[model samples]
Target: MEIDWIWGLLGGLLIGSGGAVYLLANGRIMGASGIIGGLVDGSGHATGGERLSFLAGVVTLPFLLTLMFGAVATHITGNLAVLVIAGLLVGIGTRLANGCTSGHGVCGISRLSLRGLVATCIYIAAGVFTVVLFRHLLGIV
Candidate 1:
């Protein structure tokens, strides 16, 4: 069968639960970029174990799922240059915003944070604009 809303619902619940657990257990926001950034910038050494464990779960769980359910192709472009440029752009955007969608959209909104709400709005708008501009207008993506 094709994808269904139930999978999305389950994923959302899992993400929200994980964010809540991380916040309650660590007393800190669970931003994926921030977690990895701390390691790259040497600022998260104090909590390196937690970060590493979280990262491990993030990577491993998806592989386990794919193993059980079969591979789900993203159908993304295989061009290395395009992929690298996209990665760099994402990193720059994430840094400029001070957080990613998970940080602002999930954790921040959950706590009624104004910044999070605003950030999430901006993120969604930007994503929509990008898709329209690239896929529809320019036909470049």
Candidate 2:
């Protein structure tokens, strides 16, 4: 029996819970872009250690999960240029949107923020359009 849905559901729960806990503990919105951006621009110097710890958990937890449950097939492309371009695009989009999917879709929506809702909608629409264009029209992605 496949446990894909189970894993996804659990991941969602964990993410939601983490956001809630972060909000309660830090009194700040749990936006990945904001956290990293502040650190990169030195605006969050006071919270640099906190941000580093959060990022460490973000990178480490997945590795630990794979170590415990074995690796899962991601079907990622092997092309380094494509990967770099994709990462750059994502970073740019996150900057433009002022948040990421986790920040707007999860935390912002949960808090019923209008800006978050609107940004989430726009990004989702853009994502759908991109997939349709690249996958169907251009056969790129």
Candidate 3:
């Protein structure tokens, strides 16, 4: 209904298509969270230079986009502690699960992997429960 919604959909489509293309062409899934986690852990799969470049791209792309488009980004006014904790939790979860949402939900699902299906279901359920718990039960948004 809104222009923002259309833009968001277009962005999602581009991301999904790019991810699929990357996977098909390179045989590597494009999962940002997993990539960052791997870089932090230094798991021997990705080199230091590669990891740093990936991190830089992830961090700087948004700024570059904003600079080019002159769009006002939404400010996330929240406690830094909460944000850090949430990021840590997500990092741990992805490590434990062996993949992040984009890896399992998009790449895995497209490949018809059973593990991906189950992981995606659990991911959605957990996300829903978290939202309900925080917004309704705890009265926090």
Candidate 4:
């Protein structure tokens, strides 16, 4: 396999392991949106300590890695308006769906929840369509 595939596999395994750990330890789904949303909305105040610690780890570990290694280069669109709109749309979608990809795709699907399965399918289809429409049809890529 290619190095990219190897890294992807490792990353996926780590993500799944983290999700499993969160569920087993805290009885919570390891969804980034849910975690952050709860904290933002003050709902996480009930389990403030755990939420805070988890967020801290999420924020700190990445910076620590970058400091130890090097910054992973990324390409983002120069359009700030597009970026802002995209973020807002994603936030709205997550709220409407009552969960994010991590919760639905990883934790929920693992437990054979129909909602998760359906949501994952729908989102995947939407993503594929979006990519095709933009990259192939409009040459946006």
Candidate 5:
């Protein structure tokens, strides 16, 4: 296997463990989508300052990681409009689903949640369908 695979696996393990710890300690779910949505909507129990800090940490962590490791982040060589549209779609989907892949696929699956199982299935199906539609049907690959 490649070194990148090892790193990916380790990172996933760390994230999953951290999420489990958060759930256990705080009696809260570690759903990134939910956290972001709550932060934006200001509907969650967390205070404004706490939400801002949490959101800031989420947004800054990737940059900090890249800086500390001297690793260049992957760049998408696609049209800017496509990227923006895709991002917006993903954000909307996450909000509608109440969580993202990390939340449902990892945390929810680990806890044997029915909603998580269904959500993860839908996420995978949507991803596969999108790839097929764009690359095969639309010849956009």
Candidate 6:
């Protein structure tokens, strides 16, 4: 098999395992937005330590890995306004949906939640629509 597939499989397993662990340990869905939002808004005070540790691991693991291995190239938009607006929209959308993809797609769907199923469908549809609009119709990448 290709290295890409191996890495993808490893990454997916790690994500699923992490979500499972968080759910089992804390009885909370492992949503990035909810985790960070709780921390910033003081709503996660009951699990502040766990949340902080999770955030720390998330923030530092890649840097630690880079230090051990090498830096990975990333492509990001050069337009700050566009980046900011996109971030805001994502935040707003997640809030409206009550959970992010990780929460709805992985944990919620695993639990057989109708909301998760609907949200995941909506997210995928919106993503496809956005890609078509931006990349095909508007000639933007």
lDDT per residue (tens digit) for residues 35-141 in model 5: 77887777775555555665687779888988898877577747787788888998899988888987888888888999999999988998899889988999774
Tell me the spans in candidate 5 whose CA falls farther than 4 Å from its real position. Answer: none
User: Against the true structure, whose lDDT is highest?
Assistant: 2
Off by over 4 Å in 6: none
Q: Candidates 2 and 3: which is better by lDDT?
A: 2
lDDT per residue as tens, model 1, 61-122: 99999999999899998878778988998787776777888898888898899988998998
List candidate 4 stretches off by more than 4 Å: none
For residues 1-141, could you state the per-residue lDDT of candidate 6 as single tens digits? 469998989998999999988889888789888888777678778888988898898989999999999988788878787789889989888877878888888888989999999999999999999989988998766
Provide the lDDT at 116 for model 6: 93
Off by over 4 Å in 2: 1-3
With a 3 Å backbone cut-off (N, CA, C), the pairs that clash in candidate 4 are none
User: What is the per-residue lDDT of model 4 for residues 46-128, given as tens digits with 9 covering 90 to 100?
Assistant: 88788788889888988999999998877887778768877898888887787778988888799999999999999889889
Pick the winner on lDDT between candidates 2 and 5.
Answer: 2
RMSD of each: 1.7, 1.7, 2.3, 1.7, 2.2, 1.7
Please report the TM-score between candidate 1 and the true structure.
Answer: 0.90
**lDDT of each model, Cα atoms only?**
0.87, 0.88, 0.78, 0.85, 0.80, 0.87
Q: TM-scores of all models?
A: 0.90, 0.90, 0.82, 0.90, 0.84, 0.90
TM-score of 4: 0.90
Candidate 2 clashes: the total is 0
Query: Model 2: per-residue lDDT, tens digit, 86-110?
Result: 8998888887787998889899898
lDDT of prediction 1: 0.87
Cα lDDT tens digits, model 3, 1-141, are: 469899889988987986876567656677776767777787836555655665687679888988998877576648787688778888889888877878888778878989889999998999899989987998766
Put the candidates in lDDT order, highest first: 2, 1, 6, 4, 5, 3
